[model samples]
Target: MLWTIIGIIFVLWLLGFLFDIAGNLVHVLLVIALIVFIFQMMAGRRKG
Candidate 1:
């Protein structure tokens, strides 16, 4: 689920960059998604 969200955010960021619309917002979202993904991974590792 987290990976899916990250993938969607990445795709959106790519599209935004190509179309030059809300590039900054998309970039910020991508960064946020990356952070969330990293946190999720860390938590999963600790759980195991």
Candidate 2:
């Protein structure tokens, strides 16, 4: 579930990056997604 959400966020981020939309907001969102993905991975690793 987390992976799926992360994947969606990644695709959206890629689309935003490619299209250059939303200006700084897109960049901030991309960074936030990255951080969330990293935190999810870390949590998953600890659980495993």
Candidate 3:
């Protein structure tokens, strides 16, 4: 689920790069997604 969100956001970010539509918003979401991905990785590592 988390990965899905990250993937979707990443796709949108790439689309923004090509189309220049809502580029800023997509970039922000991409950053948020990256932060969440990092946090998830950290939590998973601790549990394992």
Q: Each prediction's TM-score against the native?
A: 0.91, 0.65, 0.94
- Candidate 1 lDDT, tens digit per residue, 1-48? 887999899999999999998859999999999899889899999999
lDDT of each: 0.91, 0.78, 0.94
Among all candidates shown, the one with the greatest lDDT: 3
Per residue, candidate 3 scores C-alpha lDDT tens digits across 10-36 of 999999999998949999999999999
List the lowest-lDDT window of 10 residues for candidate 1.
1-10
What's the CA RMSD of model 1 in angstroms? 0.8
**lDDT, model 1, position 6:** 90
Q: Write candidate 2's Cα lDDT for 12-41 as tens digits.
A: 777888997666776676678779889988
* Candidate 1: segments with Cα more than 4 A from true spot: none
Clashes of 1: 0
Candidate 2, after superposition: displacement of residue 28 in Å? 0.4
Screening candidate 1 with a backbone cut-off below 3 angstroms (N, C-alpha, C), the clashing residue pairs are none
lDDT of 1 at 16: 96
Among the numbered candidates, top TM-score falls to 3
Name the regions of candidate 2 deviating beyond 4 angstroms. Answer: none
